[model samples]
Target: MLSMREFWNIVSISLCVQAQISQQLSDTGHTWNYDDGENDWSKNYPFCGGTHQSPIDIYSNIKYDAALTPIQVVGYDSPGIDHFTLSNDGHSVKVSLPATMYISSLKHKYTAVQLHLHWGDQKRPQGSEHTFNDRRFAAELHILHYNSDKYVDSQTATAKEDGLAVLGILLEVGSFNPTFENIQKYLSQVAYKDQEVQIPAFSIRNLLPVTLNEYYRYNGSLTTPPCYPSVLWTVFRQPVKISQEQLFSLETALFSSNVGDSIPQPMVNNFRQKQERAKRELLASFKEDFTFPIAIAFILGIFVIVAIIIYIIRKRRARQQSESRKRVMYAAAQKAEGTSSIEI
Candidate 1:
């Protein structure tokens, strides 16, 4: 019953609002999800289409930054917080961290904010964001931090260059990881979207690899949309292990839909596909070496030499035993001939 002009005006206003969705500071109000594919995110979030994106493929195309020193963290063992807020933010399960834990290895002190995970479903187990030499892991964990020295808060830091630092740890299936269970045991509580729970505080450092010295460093953006190009990424070369059952627990426990939804969607494969590294320089804290290949070659050569030595020793023993048997037979034959001659 409305006039034509009013209908057109409403359409224009809706289009205008959609255009501004990309400019929003928080993703809380947006409808971006792993569903319908990640390519759709770039449409609404302009930064998601930017060049300096994250979750890049890490392979032989990397630089050995000899100048890059080992990673050093402060107050990780004691995060100075009693309880953490674990919430399912519709996309993934996140745990809020304390500002007291800061990383001291970078140019500025980057304080801890929150951490989250990305994983695949039971059907396809591998879902890590970053790939190493084209190899994918079972899952990925991202620990987010903001530049404390230069920025007032995490939100303010998101707009600045080199304002964020993220530690990306690749997770593989193996023995049960108790540190991971501290968070996993509480995943059921935050099973639905926007649901949250309180978890006991533990050593944040334990979540990372025991040796934090070696990693791949680069300047990239946040993997999630409004993919701000402000992160200094450190992806460890070594992967941590979680039991198969534990991995299944993660893939099956959570849902992307809110509680009481008519049709619930499982929160699985909640990872963004890797973005192009584009002309960015990737740095490694450790020196590149042929140690693995060299060690394998050395071990093979030693094995071959031992096999030849054993063959020669066995041949020599067989020859000696055959010569001794021939001598005894010949002595017995000579004795029988002598007895026949004496009888004649």
Candidate 2:
């Protein structure tokens, strides 16, 4: 028999999961059946039939029509309340109400909360999104934010079409990133689970891509449960790189211990299942195939028009020159005939 406290703890945790998943079957009528234990490739290796599986490649056959207006970054503040919040274990960081932030298709301002990482013992070569260009990132950072206006009241939690946004920044292996170093300074205290430190002076705006002007935007779920399909996702076309050593340090820090004693398993692959397109256009900012052809056609058309104008101008000039030369020759002939008369 469990004590009252223990029973409440169990109940509390259960309710939290239910709230996050929004009653198992999502509001859009899809069921989430992917549990880590159930979907383990070694055990469920050849059997799990659920479409909502983990580690699906991101860019697989998805073609975005046009990219959205890059979200404006108002400002970034340190880790503080309503500004920067923490997870129970400091595994995640959130920033709220980012100033001047905008999503192309949405109708509200989004507040970024915390950013965190997900990784495997080795960087999964295939990557988190099922169709990344044949390789996986060392780790990925998800910056989570919610619509401040939509959830203004407590009663509107499950409302669909609510304004929620998440920006997924893919981290690849490369040289050092200054932002990563800034984040690392806090790990000494809050690196472990349930240990959180608040640094209210770090500006998240710097973390954005210099070319946020272009990206792929789509409607997708939270990747995690309640698997809320409310997210308007803006995944950038550019990838930021971190050194292998830095990557290892960050991965190590995510473990149950700061020293990497054991693998830390929180939400290994929290990305949601790709939903039906529902006839919505996936926007890409810098489109090559479609835009390139149209641009080429436009340039050729302009060139043709300019060439015609040049030809007409040259013809007019040549006609004027010919007339002037003829008049000069006629005048010379008359002058020669008059000179013979003078000689007699």
Alpha-carbon lDDT, every model? 0.88, 0.54
Error of 2 at 46 (Å): 22
- Best model per TM-score: 1
What clash count does candidate 2 reach? 29
Of candidate 1, the 10-residue stretch with the lowest lDDT total is 11-20
Instruction: Return the TM-score for candidate 1, rounded to 2 decimals.
Output: 0.79
TM-score against native, each model: 0.79, 0.57
lDDT of 2 by residue, 176-251 (tens): 7877776665554555555665554565656666667666666655554344345667777677777776665654
RMSD of 2: 14.0
Where model 2 places Cα greater than 4 Å from the true spot, the runs are 1-35, 38-56, 60-67, 77-106, 123-131, 153-159, 256-281, 289-344
Residues 1-344 of candidate 1 have per-residue lDDT tens digits of: 87999986774454345334655634446678888988887777877886789888998667888888888999889988899999999989999998888899888999999999999999999999999877889999999999999889997777566689999999999999999998999999999999999999998888889899899999998888778777899999889999999999999999999899999999999888888887899989888788999999999999999999999999999999999999999999999999999999
- The clash numbers for all candidates, in the given order, read 0, 29
Best by lDDT: 1
